[model samples]
Target: MAEQDGAIYDRLTRVPERDWDKNAGLDALLNGAREPFVLRGFVADWPLVQAGQRSAADARRYLLDHARDRPFTVSIGPPGHDGRLFYDADMAMNFRTGTGKLGDIFAGIEASEAQDDPRTVYLGSIDIPAHFDGLDEANPIDLGDRDPLHSVWIGTRTRIAAHNDFPDNLACCAAGRRRFTLFPPSQFRNLYLGPIDNTPAGRAVSMVDFDAPDLAAHPGFVAAMAEAQTVELDPGDAIFIPSMWWHHVEGLAPFNILVNYWWRDTPAWLGQPQEALNHAILAIRDLAPEDKAIWREMFDHYVFANDGRVTDHIPPAARSVLAPLTSESAGRLRAFLLRALNR
Candidate 1:
């Protein structure tokens, strides 16, 4: 909506923001980007954006009208939370989740906005087709050939900690303004990640508080801040977050809604790397030091640093699982793991 400078958040660099590229292929740029970027007013013509521009009430009505008769899972934070959804001192989640309709959440946000200390009413990651049915077709962003799983995030004045997603994201500021502070995948070490298996959300988030980071407590964050890129997007603008890029998001307005499309560039049949990571923890984390060294070399040879000649000692046909994985072979491998893990 307006030109912005990332002078805040320790003077983080601003993400590259510009109008959509029509000459160079849009699909390729979004799917293959190694960095994050803002597509300014990319979804300006969306009905939701137009409705939101008119009034908050108009936006709320538009969503309710499009929404199906399905109960939504809502996350509610206590008053004075400053809309940060996170764990308490005991490592328990600070907020509580419950079932509610969209109207309830809208009312709660409106009510919270009026209060001295505001409660966080966040409706996060509801699948569009399941919840809103025809919203995607109605307010569409042509993703070219990509068939994505669209999800809607509606909330008010929320702080979502820095986290990465497996799939690349196209986050549209459908209604209100949003500020995203991003870190590259290489800055993973500096993010101060929490327990992987035990997270408030599915993804592990950085423990550092963006509002007031305790630098001494999290010394690594100082380094992270050096590499950070921040951007503020107004209604109708969108941002593309590449897979594994860390982002801490903020819902800036009293009544806010974001529609994001997520899709992996890989084949749908491919399993998540997280599952393999979890399995490795169970089987390998505490292995004898000497044995661990052996496994590390083996992983590097077969997976990480393999140049297709690691199995040259064996005949090509005899390589079995060492061969390049086709869809059928991947299925077989997955099935084998299920049986082995079950035993």
Candidate 2:
């Protein structure tokens, strides 16, 4: 019985196989239509290379030059911190702002560039041809981009602590091997996040001690650690991290080059009035302890419960809202949300 139980746990916790099924899981999660999913080896087409290659050098140069041209923000690591940022070119300039300063910056860039460029990182969208060479026959996932998605992340090793992004990210290592410690969105409680007011860098938190973690201090973290996944990415090896999954990245090597695609499984509702509700929550309701507590309870009631339990609460009138869970239901819910939101 013990051996069988262990096997079942392993099957549930181990990374899923990289295949269509897993990809479906990722797509479902990104669409907010399903639970967390793991897609392994989804980016096997990316070619890996060592640090000395010209491709790596070119990527680094492009990143630094782009960052220099733009008013990019930077986070300098304090002394004795494991954070260090270095670029092959001296053109890389550092910009530091107080917490929450970069929010407007991120909003502005996304507004102007038609792409997400939070954290002052240079992100080349996936539709540009300059980024992908042999993608024609690669059976690539159609992310509606004519160009290959790429980005250059230049930051101190400890600059970005830990957080999750809204869109699914496929990051390719070009110059350095970054050690990524990933936790599913379900582990958010264990992370102990910072303030949400901080923009670009949102809700900073460290999942584990760099040198030593006091397990006693955070007992819940032990379960989080048990479910934690680690990947050391070298040049050419890309990691497909599902949307909203918490991650901490340590730049194991200097001049780290990373190209990534931030793709959403669903279309974004731009210029929607519903955004006002989000703003109101952040600006007002979130401040009141009673209101916040009520909101938290609502989330726990509707969002955190198992699918079986929560699905029952979804009314037939709102059944369409739950249709994202399956392809058969997506159209109904999509239309419903679109109409309901008047978007």
- State which candidate has the highest TM-score: 1
What does the lDDT read for residue 288 in candidate 1? Answer: 99
Minimal lDDT window, size 10, model 2: 84-93
Writing each residue's lDDT as its tens digit, candidate 2 over 2-37 gives 212334233334333244443443343344332333
lDDT of each: 0.85, 0.48
lDDT of prediction 1 = 0.85
TM-score each candidate: 0.94, 0.53
In model 2, the runs with Cα more than 4 Å from the true position are: 1-72, 84-150, 155-159, 270-343
Model 2, residue 287: C-alpha shift (Å): 9.2
Tens-place lDDT digits, model 1, residues 23-142: 454776675677888888788889999999998889999999988888999999998878889999998999999998778777777665678878888889999999986788889777
